[model samples]
Every structure is written in C-alpha cells, then in structure tokens.
Target chain A: MPTKAMFLMIKQMLQRPFTNPFPVKHAPKDVTSLVEKIQKGEVKIHPPVPVPEGFRGKLHYDPERCIGCRLCITVCPANAMEWIPELRKIRHYVSRCMFCALCVDVCPGKKFPGEEKAVKALSMSDEFLIADYDKYSDNLIEEPPEAKEKGI
Target chain B: MAKTTYYIPVGPIHPALKEPIRVEAEVEGEKIVKVDVKRGFAHRGIEYMGMKRNAIQTLYLSERICGICSISHPYAFVIGSEKALGIEAPPRAQYIRTIIAELERIHSHILWLGVIAHEIGFDPLLFWTWKGREKVLDILEAITGNRINYAMYMIGGVRRDLKESHIKALRDMITYYWEFTEHMKEVFLSDPVYKARTRGVAQLSKEMALKLNVVGPTARAAGIRMDVRQDIPYDAYADMDVKAIVPQDIVGEARGDAYDITMVRLYEIEQSLDIIEFCLDNLPEGKILAIPNYVALLNKIKKTEGEAIGAHEAPRGEVIHYLKYDGTRDGPAVWKVIAPSYNNINSWAPLLLGAEVADIPVVVAYIDPCMCCNDRVAVVEDSSGRLLDYSYLHKKAVEKTRKLEKELGVRR
Candidate 1:
C-alpha cells in the first residue's frame, strides 16, 4: 500500500490556514434570458406558403381535404387519432397525443393547406410551458382553442 | 440421495431490482452454483413507436427512453440525424449541449456512488453522496427548466440559451461542488469500512471485461482504456481535449478490480468538472438553430436515405443509437437504441460469480443497473403466504441510527 504519511504532510502544507473571509455571494441570474431575447421578436405568425419542409410542429387535418384515407388512424401510436366512418373525417383527441407527429407527416392528402404548414402558420407564442396534460395533447392539433382562429 | 439444488427467482417484480429483471439462482448450501437473468418487463416497444412517428416527433419519444439519461439519447439522435442530413448546430448550442451533458454525468455518477455506498451498508456515505448530488440537479433545473428531463436539445439546435445570470449560478455551483469533492475524497479514501467492503471484491479481470464487451466505468475499472468521448469524439468533445481516466498509476500498477473501477469513476467526476469549466469559458455566440430554406430542407429530407450509428458516453456507459431513413414521409428513422445498461448488465455475470451472498447486492449495485427506470423493492413472501423474517431490516435500522449519530456530531 502507498504511504499516507508523506501525502498527509504535503496536503497539510498546501492547505490554506483559514477559510476565505468572503461575504455570502448573491444568487446568479437565470440562463433563459438569452433564449427569451431571441424568441421575443414577432415575424410572420404563419406564412401562407406550404409548411416549411422538415418542421415538426402541430398537426392540421382539413375535413374538406380529406380523401377518407385511414392511413393516419392506423399509425397513431398513442391512438389519439380516430377515423369517424360516418363523417368521413378523422377526429383527434388532444388528450392522448404523444406529439410524435406521425399522423401529420404520413397524411396523403394535399387538399386543404397541409397541417404542418398550418402549425407553422400559428405564431411562436412563448407558451412552451405545458402545465396540464390536456394542453400537451392539444398541441398535436392546430385547432385547439388555445391557438388562433385565423385559419379556415 | 444426492443433494438437490434449489432455484430461487428473485425478480421479474421484486424490491431488489429497480427495473424488472428476474434472476434465477441455483443454490447449493449458501453458494450460488448457477445464475440466469431475464429482462424486458419494462420494455414498452419504444422502437416501434419511433418508426410510427415522424423524425421530429421521435425526438420527444427518444428523450423518454430513460429519465436519468434523458438528454443523451435525444442528443445522440439529433446529432446522428444532423450528421445524416449534413447540418451543424450553432456554436452556442454546442456549448449548451456540452454543459447539460456534463451536468447529467455529475448527477448520475453521484447517484451511483450513493447507491454503491448503500449496498455496502454504509448509509452515511449514501446520504452524503445524494445530498451533494442535489446541487447538480438544482443546476440542471435552472438551466434546462426541468430537473430530470431537460428537453433542451432540438434537431437543428437547442431550445434554450445561457444568460450571464446562468453563468453566475454555475460558478456558485462549481464552488460548492469543489468543497463537496474534498469531503467525498476523504470519506472514500480514508473510511476503513468502505475500503474493507470494496477492496478485492467483485474482481473483473481485464481479459474478461474485454471479452464481455463491457462499456463505461465497469470496463474502465478493469483498465480497458475505452470511453466513447475520448475514443470517438462527438459534440464539443472533439473541440476540447478529452482524457480517459485510469487507475492511479502514481500509487502502483493497475490491479483491474472493483476498487480500481470505483476510483476511475470518482476521478472522472473531477475530469468532467474540468471539461465544464473549459466549455463555459469558451462560450460562443451565434444563432442557436440553422434556418434552412423550407423548400431545400423538405426536398433534401424527402430524398435522404441511409443508416448512421451515433454513440455517446452516457453516465452509465456508451449509449448507441442506430438510425435508418428510407425516403419515407416519416423522414428517416428506423431507430434502434442500445443503452449502456445493455453492456453493463451482462458484465454482472462474471463479477457476481464466485462472490459471497452478502456481496451480491453490492456487486450488482456497482453496475448501476437502471432496471428499466423502475426500482421499487417488493416484500418477499414465503410459500405459506407469510412475510419473510425481517432480519436485514433490523440491520438496516441500526445502520441508519449510526448514520444519524454521525450527522448529529455524536461520536459512536
């Protein structure tokens, strides 16, 4: 085993005789100020141009553009999207959505404006805080009451 | 008649394991003759879910793989996809990623230290380690806005940025952590019982560690000289000079045992502090995200095809993510995640064999198994529907009393 006596002597010599006689330091600033500054300015809330490619925002389902394709209903992992056979449209419950964005990306119809584009159309509100479970689920659909009513 | 070997199944659901793993031990007398481990109880088919979701959605799902390793999985996936798509995150984002990753490492290593101490019946060390670990979590919460799951890393870049205030908070934390490290070193190195319990126990030879494909601290303990950060640099590791830790060479040559492994992890914590300080001092400024032209991004993503493997040195060990994209609307992710636990879990076999029954818990705890993020210990019941004797319970209580006395400044 290594000798501790020599190391202890060295450590004692190196040690400061007293703790630093400094006053208690004040709490530091929150780090999010930098992000807040960047996200603060308002640009176009939602551009009319087709949703930018590779954007994973909220999902949009246009009933008018529905081709009655059941592809999305089958692929929803959280089982959030349901096909209403009678209405020939998909009803998505915001409660179970994992926001995996499978339904919006896989939707075959280009009928009405794409849901991905519609989501991008919604302004980037600083409401990233999802307090209630319902609000998080609601994020999957663009028409959640929390979102604006500009889109038709 | 020949003596029959008794097989006892510890858990697919038991108090001892955090996740659901069933250990079937064949015992003759108190000696375990054979052992088999079975898992998959907590497997929620995350890979299949990832396939079903688009690339963007899968990011959130990947973060949920392990609560403790929340940032690493997403960071690996994002970096992998970004590499596949040929995009670079902003300089500031890179620094933020590095900071968060180190913070995660600090919390994870401290937590593991506490558990290891607990397993060895040293409750005071466990308490002190965990108490110190809280400082790391507090720093994490201040930076990422969440304690366990930071959710800061995005595909193109990061969602949050560090302000001047954040830097000040971090500086304060570093000071406290420095003080804590001095205390930890004293306890770990000077404590007679800790040395007695850990030294020469659960010995993993270098050859066996290499053969088993062990990763992380477990392999490091055995002097394997493998760390993904040092070996294959990713994120900010390439930018910074990363060094892999080994057993103390100044003291003597490597012994390749449990004590050496513990020492490696403790020393690595100091190294992580160095890396964090370097990253903070060199904080860069720029846009956090790459705003590619929508048309170009979509067209490129639509046509993108191929597979790439991204590996990160997570707190436990190397976490490898295999991603494949086949020009589908889902935008490239037939994703397969292999956590560090996968490699570390198998190593338990070699270490646990030929060890005493009392040493089993400590040896197993050393691996720092996740148990699939579920670690509730269940009450053991006998065949007659009666609770087993609580002999270990009394011992634990006495241990707790001793710990309290130490904390209260009472000499035992």
Candidate 2:
C-alpha cells in the first residue's frame, strides 16, 4: 500500500494540478480586451477540464424544426418550460432549468415517411458558462435560428 | 466539588454534522449518560411534489430525493411504477439498469468513505479516496449525460443506451476500483489509528439492529443477514444470487462498530464491481424501452389503478417507495417513501447513550446518514413556540380539508 502511495506521489508531482486555482484563470478588467488579446495571440487562455461526449449542459433549441407538440412541457420536472398559447411555442427559463435533459428526451424531432431528422428541436449544448446577471436575459432565451436572416 | 453531569446539544447545527439533526447528550466524565435524537429539520416535501406531477415527470423528480444515492429513489420509483402499470422493461434494459445502479453504488460508497474519513480528521485519506472516486464519476457522466440527477431512468426502461465506448469505460473503471478498494482496506481496516478511533465506537448488536428495523449497510454492519436485493429481488437482481455482506463472515465476531462499517463498505465496492462486470458480459441486445413514447406511457399510468411497493439496496441502505394510482390521474394518487436513514436513526439514541463525547461524529458518520432522504414530513410548531403533537396536527389537517370543501361549495 505504501508503495502505491509512493507511485501516486511521484505521478502527481510530475502531473499538472488537477484543480483550478482559487480565482480561476485569466481574469481581466474587461472581456472585450481579453478577447482582443487572445485574437492577437498575445495571451493564451488555459482551457478548463474536458467534458465527456454528450454532456448535458445548457439548453439549445431549434425553433424552426419545433412542432410545438408540448411533450417537453409535459415531462419537464422543473416546470422550466412556459407555454405561449398565442405563439404556440414554449419559452424556457434557463434559471429554472435543472439541466435534467428530460425535455430534450421528449422532443418530437421532425420525421418524414422514411428517414428521421438527425437532431431534435431541443437539445443540450456544451455551453455551460451560462451564469448571467439577468435571469430573463435575451442571451438565455432560445431565440429563433432565423432571427438573424429575418431580423425578428 | 466535581460536577455530576453536563448537558450538551450537538446539533441542529454543529461542526461535525454535515446535515441538520439535533442530538442532545448528557455526559458525566466523558461518558454519555443519556441521549435524545431529534430529526425532522430537513424535509422538502419531495413526495408531495411528485404526486402533483405526471408519472414520467414524477419518476425524474424522485431521483432528486438524495444527493449521494441519486439512482436509488428513481430505482424504487420506476420499479413500483412498472409494477402498478404491469409493464416490464426489456431484458437488456434490466441489465442496463443494474449496471447504472451498481456504478452509483460504487461511487456512493467511496463518497461515504471519504466523508467518514474527513469526520475523523484524516484529511489525506479523504483526499485520496475522493481522488480515486473521480474515476467512477467520470464513467457515470460518460454513460448517463450528467454526474448526478442522471435523469436516465424512465418508467418502464432507461433513457440512454449504453454505447460501446461507455462499456469500455465501465470495464476500465471496474478494474480501477478493484485495486482502489485493496488500498482502502489497508488504510481503513488494518491501520492502527483508524481502528482505535472506530473499533468500539457506535457498537450495535444483532438483536438491537433487528428490533430497530434498520435497513441497508447499517444493519449489515450489525451482522443482520438481510438485504433488499437478497430478500425481495427485482429486475436483474431477480436472477443473481446477492447475499448480504455481514461483518461476522469476514471477522470472527460481529462488533458492529464503525470500523466494521468501513470494512463492509469497502468490500461492497468490490461486490458492486462484480455486479457491473457480470452485467456487461451478459448484456442482451434489444429495445431499451418497453413504452418509448412518453405520452403513451403517461396515458397508461392514468388508466392504471393499482398500488405497489418497491425496495432497493442503496449504498447507504434500502430506499422503499410506495405508489398508488386511482385510474384518474397520470401521477401517483399517494406517494410515500421510507429512506433507510429513518430506520437507521432509531439506533442513534441507544448507541450514543453510553458512548464517549468524542465518539459523536464517529457514530453519526457511521450511519452514512442522509437527512434530506429521511425527513419527508416537517415538524409542526405553533406560533407560541409550543410543540404540536401528532393528534393535534391530524385534527388541523382534517379541518383544512373541510374548510376547502366549504369554500369551494363542494360537500363530502
């Protein structure tokens, strides 16, 4: 047992630290300035720990493909999906989402006679850095994918 | 003149306690003379919340009942729900469910080992054990989307299929834990300091364990030959011969102390690894879900009228869920849960009665207690700060029901 401990000691000594430092990496006065510095290759921001494939993080919605079946609403344990009867769509409150991914499971992705759509309308993206000052911020909302083209 | 005795209240809040529970102990010269354990500080009304939702939603909600054994509540809930609805998960699905549950058990047991070590002020051991535990958690995340609150278990089957990559990860993890547990035995079982702190601490007897009705590993530590998997088998467990792990079988006599508990948990980790390996080798190929359609599943639950009890051997102990469907609502008409900590808590007062003051944390941590899992019902206190007894609360409940009926112009 002590031999194992010795091996672990040497191994950890050579390995990079497993945990983040107290303040974390690369804090600056402004995010815009930090982005500029990174773009110019003057600074290198360290990457965080690698998440596994198919990680459940923030909610991502494909409104164009959405059929509005409301099955996601029925199975969402957190009540994070709000039904808009007039719009016939669901509005998500990311602050209330527990990231359980149950809504994504119940999503009725587009299907033709022979082939199924590759992706569901609602899915879990890898973007987990979703902390924001506004709980109802525009960034947190699942804006329509066509908003840029149609200027909605 | 020397004082005869001193009264000390260890909780609702204390340094040693990780959760909210009150234990009042009277001590005379470091020897506890009497003890009283007062719980009901951590109830969240999760069962009540579950009953208000549809069956599938309630299934995921039950997974949040305990933070450590996240899979245990949902296992029991799905088992009970499937029984009430008369739906059987595919054979492959049953094996997959067993795999995930065993993975959770390995992780939970390691977590408890770290917690108990930290309680005893062995910080290095805590760090090392948790570091080793990260392997299992990583595999769990790879297989089930998230590390905790997996949201992976459906009513009749599991949500995700175990891919080839996932099985490879699990097999590697099983090997890692097999070696990890051996080192744990050296550190926790045979170490002189660990044994000194825990050898005679929280000692319980076989008769006392049976009388208290404790379930899970806490009862097993006292050499009780009972386990939910072994007694009332379900799913893949129905086929496997899972015998309970008792301390007396390993050691000559059953001291049923904290040291024995450490040993029991460490061995159980190997047992879980065996279960996982068995599942991986025997995993059948077929559809993973009996009723893959969520809408169809909820509709079936609405039309079903039945009641069933499901029990599972969680890392801490047995978690049992009672569900009833009245053929009216999609969710359970009534939902009741009996977490192992509720029954294991019965031994606290008796064990702490004669224990030394220093042994408080030892006794408390030995149970691997989950306050949130146990305290499903809240304690009622009146405005004047008087404790309301059971009958008074029952009368108040009835009055409220009658008041609601009158207000709504509905008569019973």
Across residues B253-306, which tens digit of lDDT does each residue of candidate 2 receive? 777889888888888998888888888998999999999988888889889899
Q: Which stretches of candidate 1 lie over 4 Å from their true place?
A: A1-152, B1-4, B248-250, B292-300, B373-412
lDDT of 2 at A36: 87
Tens-place lDDT digits, model 2, residues A32-129: 87788878988777676677888998999877667788888888989998776655667787888888888887787776457755458898989888
**Native-contact recovery for every candidate?**
0.02, 0.52
DockQ agreement of candidate 1 with the native complex: 0.04
Candidate 2 chain B, run of 10 with poorest lDDT: B186-195
- Docking category for candidate 1? incorrect
- Quality class of the docking in candidate 2, CAPRI style: acceptable
Leading candidate by lDDT:
2
In candidate 2, residue B389 scores what lDDT? 94
Off by over 4 Å in 2: A1-41, A111-119, A143-152, B2-4, B381-412
Q: State the weakest 10-residue window (summed lDDT) of model 2 chain A.
A: A143-152
